[model samples]
Target: MPRFTAQELDAHRAKVTQLLDKPSIKVGMSTCGVAAGAVLAFDTLVEEAKSKSANILISRTGCAGMCSMEPLVEVCIPGQPAAMYGNVDAELARRIINEHVLSSQPIVERLVPSIEALAVAYDKSDTPTPPGASGPRQYRIVLRNCGVIDPESIDEYIAREGYQALQKALSGMTSEQIIEELKVSGLRGRGGAGFPTWHKWQLTRDAQGDEHYIICNGDEGDPGAYMDRSVLEGDPHSIIEGMIIGGYVIGARQGVFYIRAEYPLAVQRIEKAIRQARAAGLLGKNILGTEFSFDLEIRLGAGAFVCGEETALIASVEGKRGTPRPRPPFPSVKGLWNMPTMINNVETLANIAPILVRGGKWFGSIGIGKSTGTKVFAVTGKIKNSGLVEIPMGTTLREVVNGICGGIASGRRVKAVQTGGPSGGLIPEQHLDTPVSYEHLQALGSIMGSGGMIVMDDTDSVVELSRFYLGFCVDESCGKCAPCRIGGTQILRTLNRIADLKGTERDIATVRRIAHAMQKASLCGLGQTAPNPILSALRYFEPEFMERIAAAKTARKEPGIARK
Candidate 1:
C-alpha cells in the first residue's frame, strides 16, 4: 500500500486549505533573501507574532525575484489586499507583525507597489492564460509555487496540487499519448539548445535498452545566473515529480539529480524532499500504489562548468574526470553506462507537471509562435530590478528590460543585453525590441541559452565585455579539446590588446579568425560557443574596436583594467 493514497492526498489538501484560509505572513527565505538577512526577519516575525498572540500563520517561502528588494515579507489578511513588503530587516519584520498582523493597519511606505496594485499579476496561473501578454510584467508557470510555498514542507507542495499530475500521467496516459501531448505543447528544452522536448523523449523511448535513466541537470555554473538554482531550491518537489513522470514514460527504473556542491541549501532541500517522497511512496518501487516503479538519488558535481554538458555530466557521475566526449552517440541513444538516458535541466522538468495538469493545447496557447510557454530569466546587471523574471516567451526584450526590469538604473543608455551566459552573444540595444524566442534571439546572433540575461549600460566597454566572457570560457575549458583551448586563449589575448588601447587593426582580424576556427572545430558546445561574445562584439560593436586602436597613439595610455 502507498503511504499517501488519493483520498489521503485529498484530505491533506483540504487540511492545507484551512491553514491557508487564515491570515498568513510569508517571508522570502531563499539563498538571495537569506544573504540579505531573511533568516533574522523570519525569526523576528515568528517571535513578534507569538508575543502579540496574533491569529496569523507565520511561514517561509522561496525568493520571488526582486532580489534587490529582498528580504521580502508578505501579509495576506482574510479579505484585504496582500501587502507585500521589500527590503525587510528584523526591525521591519517586527513592525509588520505588530502593525499589520496585530493591528490590521498596513505600513504603506513598505508595500511593494507592483504586487499591491496588480495583485494577481504574479499569481499561480493554475489555468491557461492568454499568450501575447506584454500588459502584465510576468506570467509564471515554472515559478508558480516559488515564493508561495515553504520549501521544506511537503504538505505545502501537496496543497498546491503537486503530485496530482504524476498520478494523472500514470493512470490515464500511455507513453505515446504523453509524447503526443508534449508534441502538441511545443515544449523545447530550456537548457540552451532549445531542442524539441517531445522529440528527445521519443528518441529515448524508442531507443532499445533494457535499462533507462532520467537525469536532472542542476549543475548551474553560469556567473550571475540563478534561474535553475532558484527553481531547484524553491520548488524541489516539482522537479522530483517531473522526473518521476519522465521515468514512468521513458520506462526508466531510476532518476538522478546532478546538482553542484556549491548549492548547499538546494542540495539539503532536494535531499530532504527525496527522503520525504520515498517515505510517502511517491518514489521507489510501485510509486503511489501503481504498477509503475521508479526511484531517485542525488549526485553532487565538483563545480565544473563543463559538467553542465550531458556527456561530461554522465562521465563525472561514472567516476571519470568531468569532461565532454564527442557526440553522435548522444545521451538519448547511449548514455550513463551505455544505457538510454534522458537529461533535462531544472527549468525543463519544472514545466512537465504543469503541462500534464492543464492539457498540452492549453500550454501551447500561452506563448507566441513556436515558442510556446513562459521562460524564467535570471535578470542581473545594470538593470533597476535585478533578480528572477519569468515572462511569457513572446514578450519583447524591451518589455523585459524597460517594462519589467525598469530599464538601466544608472540613467545611462543600455549598450547591450547579454543572454545565454558566457556562451551567448551580445544583443545591441537597437535590437532589444525583438521577442525573446529561440529563432528571434538566434537571428540577432545570440542563443536563448539557459536564460541568463545580463543588461549592460553605455559606460560598459564592449572590448572588456568580450574579454571577460572569453576569459571565463578559457578558464573553464577542460583542455581536452584543442580548438576551444587554443582559439579561446588566442581570442582573449586580442581582446586584452584592444581593451588596453594597444591593438593594431590586424588584432581584430586575428580575433575573428580564431573565433571562427573555435566555432567550427571545437569538440563540444563549450568550445563551439566560447567565442560568441567576441564574435558578437565584432559583429555589432566593431567601431568600438577600430576607434580604440585608431586613437591608441593620441589617447593617453592607461594600465590594463584588472578583472574583478
Candidate 2:
C-alpha cells in the first residue's frame, strides 16, 4: 500500500464509506462464540454460501458483548432490518442462510437488534423511548468495530473507517492538539482508577525520558470478564492504531502488548494484525511515510492475575516474575527497563483512534458526566442474552440487565449485579435504577473495573457468590505482600464461615474491619480491593448473613434444648 497524505486519506475514507452501501453478514466469532460452536456455524455459512452461489458476504468478527447468547450471527441485507441470531448451531446457521440471506426475510423470533437498530427504532416509535425499544439498547463507541468487522484482516477494518482515525490524528493533529482533544473528550482510563486519559499522556510526555514505551494491557484475569479479550480478538487493529496514536503522542517508539497466553485466539489475531499493519507500512519506522517511527511486539503473559497491574505487567515484560512494586515512582516515571512508560488497557486504547477521528467533544458528549465515551461490558452470569455489550456511559443497570440482556433467564428475579471482577463489589436490586458512571458505581460500593458486569438472579446465593470471588482473589494473590496474601486468605475464611453457616455477627464485623485495613494499607490494588466482595456483600446482604447464622444456631441445638 502506498503512503497517502492527509487529503488523499480523506478521499480514500469517502471512497470506503461509499463501498459500505453493499450488504453483508457478520458472525460473532470470539472465544464466547467459539465455545458455543460459532466456528462450525461460521464454516457452515461460508461453505453453504459458496455451494449455493449466494451473493451474500460472510465475514467473521469479534464478540458483540452479549456472552450468554454465544454463537451470535448477525444478518444484514439491504432494505431489511439487521438481526442477530443467538445460541446458533449449524442447523440454525443453515436456517439463517435460507431465511435471511436467500429470502431476505428477518427471523424475528431469533433476531436481537444491535444498538444502532435500537436507536433507529426509537426514532420511529411514537413514544419517545430511550434507544433499544424492542428490548434494551446501548451505544457503541469503544467497541464500534467489534462484531462488525473481521479483526484479523486490515482491509475489512479499513473498509469500515478503521485506520481513518489514525490517519486523521497523524496528518491533521499535533501531539499537544491530540492530547488536548482527549482532555476535552472527558475520556478516562478503563483499566480501573478512571484516571483522565489526557492527563496520563501529559504526565508521560512531560516526564524526563529519552526512551519511552507504550504497553497494552491484555492480561485480563477477571473471572467473568472478557471485555479485553473480545476487543483483542474482534478488533485488534483498533488497539494497534490506538497504541500507535498513543506512541506518537508520548514520543514513544516501541509498543508491547502484554496479553495473557490463555487467550490463544486473541493472541493469534493480534499477531496477525501486527504483521498486516507492518506490511502495509502502518507500523515500523516512518509510519505512513511520516517522520514518526514506532514499532510494536507481543509479549505473552503467564496468566498471572496480578500481571494485570501496570508494574507487574512491566516486570513480566522484562523477563522477571510478574510482581508489583511500590508506587510513587509510578510507571510513567520509571517503567519497563526504568524508562518512562504509558500503559492502557485494550479497551482504553481502542477508543483513542475514534476520539481523534471524531474530535474529543463528539466522543465526550455521548455519555454522562466525567465518564465520557462508551464502555464495553462482558455481561455474564444468569442473563438470557449474555454477551459483550458496548453502551454509552451513564446507561442504567436496569437498562442493561432488563433491557439489553433480556433480564435474568426464564423470568427469574435479579438478585444482584457484580462489577469490577473479584476485587469489585456487588450492587443489589435496589440500586438497579442508578445510572452506571464511574462516580455512581463507586458511590454504590462498586467500581467499573474493566466493565465486567455479572448479573445474578434469585437462584444465586449472595454469600456463595461473595465466597466464590473472594476465593478467586485468594488463589490469584501474588503473596508478595502480607495484606493481599494473608488478609485475602483471612477474609475468604470469614466469608466461607458465613457461607458454611458457622458464623456470628462478630464475624461480619471482623470481615469489615479487615477489608477496611486492606483497602488502606495493602501494597497493591490486588491486596487493597481483595476484600471488596466480602464488604459489599456484607453491606448489601446483611440479612442473608444473619439468616445463615440463625440457621447454624438452630442446627447446633438439640431437640430437648429447642423445647426448653
Candidate 3:
C-alpha cells in the first residue's frame, strides 16, 4: 500500500523479520496443497484461532515440494522447533491451534523436519538420508522462498532479500556487468535445452531495436512437470524481480508472462503479485526511486506444447498461431512485433535474483562442472515420497530414487526412470548410479527437460510406457512439418504393435529408420525430439520387445491355446 524508496525498503525488511520472533502459523496454499484440502484446513485454523483468541499470525504460502503429504501446516513457536505437518485437515487444524499453539507441545505423530533443518543434517553426513523416515534433502536455491513466505505479501518477499538484487542492478551495475555475472555463475536455461542464459541476454541486448521486450515462458506443457507452476504460484515476486533485473540488463522497458490458461491459480497469483509490486514501486515507473522503469503484463496461452519453443512462444504472444518457424533469424534478432525479445522460463527467471544477491562465484561453486546451482524436480510415479525434490546438479539417480524419493512405492525393483516428459527418453535401472548432469542425462538418451522426473517400477511395461509418451506427442504436435506430424504417427503405430505383442524385427527396424528421419528433418524441437521415448525404450529394453514378439508367435502357432 506504500511506495518504498531503496532505503525505506531495507528498513521495512528489518521490521518484518521481527515478526518471526513471535509464534506464526503457515498453511501450504499452492495447487498441490489446495487439492489436498489445505483450503478447509486454512479456514479452520483461522476460525479456531479467532475462537481461542490465540495471539498467533496465520498466513498462506506456496508448496514446499512435498506434495505426497498435502494440506500441510507449519507452526513456529519462539523457543520450540518449527514443525511441519502433512495430511492436515480441519480437525488437525483445531488440535494444532489448541495443543501446539496454546500449549507449545508439538504433535509428534504429525511432525516433519523443516527442509532447512534437514539441510544442516545433510551437510554433516557423507551419505544422503533416505526418504520415508525423513523427507529427502532438497538443496534449494531457486525454491528458497517457496512454502516459506506468504506469496500474497510483498513484504515477506522483501524481508528475505527479494528485490535487493534488482536494486543493486538498477542503482549500481551496468547492463554488461549483469550479463557478465550471469556468465560467471554458469547459469543455464532450465527450460529443457540447458542453453547459457548469459549468452541469450547478451545477444538480445546487442540486437538492433529501439524498444525491446522480456517474456517469461510460464506455459509449462510437459506432463508431470509443475516446477514452473509452483514457482509462479509460490514465489511470483521472485519471477517479477528476476524479470526486472533481466529488463534492466537487456534494456527492455516492457515484459510479458506467457502462462497457460489451465494454471488459473498461477495466473491469479502472478497478476496479484504484479499489482502489489506496482503499488510498492517495484514494477512501474522509476522503480525503487531510480531512473530505470519497466512494466509487465500477463498473456494467457492455449495450452499448446509447441508454444514452449521460443519462436512459437513469441508468435503466440503477438496474437498469431502458436507454431514454430525457421530459426535463422531467432527471437533475439527479430521477435514480437519485429523488435528484439528475450524469453526465459519461470525457473530461469527465479534464479536471477539469487545469482545477483549472492555473487556469481558463490553460485558457481555449488554444483558440479558446467551445471552449477540446484535443480527442482517434480518427482512422481510409483515413488514413496512423490513430491518435489531439489538437489545439486551432480547428484546421482540412485540418490534421487533411493535416498530422496525412497526407492519405489511397492518396494519393487525399478524398471526405468522417465525425464523430460514426452520429449525426454528413458533411463534404465542399470544407469541409476549415473549423476544427473545435463550431459549425463543426454548420454543416457534422455534430457533434463523442465525438471519432470517420473520413476517407474518393475511392474510397469517399458514398451507400453513408450507408446503412451509417443501418443501424447502425436496428439500434441503442431503439425507444421511432415517429419514430426507423419513420423510421430508411424512411430506410434510401431510402438502399438510392439506393445500388443505382435511386432517383428522388421517392424522394429522400420520404426528406427523413421525415428532417425524425424530427428534430422523436423522443423522444430517438438518433431525432432518426439521419437526420443521410443528410441530410448528400444535402446534400453529391446530384449523385452523381442520377448513379446516370441510370445505373439507362439500364440499364433497354437490356435486353441490362450495367450499367457
Candidate 3 yields a Cα-based lDDT of: 0.87
Winner on lDDT (1 vs 3)? 3
Encode model 3's per-residue lDDT on 254-281: one tens digit a residue: 9999999999999999999999999999
Model 3 weakest 10-residue run by lDDT: 120-129
| Cα TM-score per model | 0.95, 0.92, 0.96
Residue pair clashes in candidate 1: none
Off by over 4 Å in 2: 2-19, 95-100, 103-110, 118-136, 559-564
- List lDDT for all candidates, in order: 0.86, 0.82, 0.87
Q: Which segments of candidate 3 are over 4 A away from where they belong?
A: 120-136, 559-564
| Model 1 regions more than 4 Å off | 114-135, 553-564
Best by lDDT: 3
Candidate 2, residue 310: how far the Cα is off, in Å: 1.3
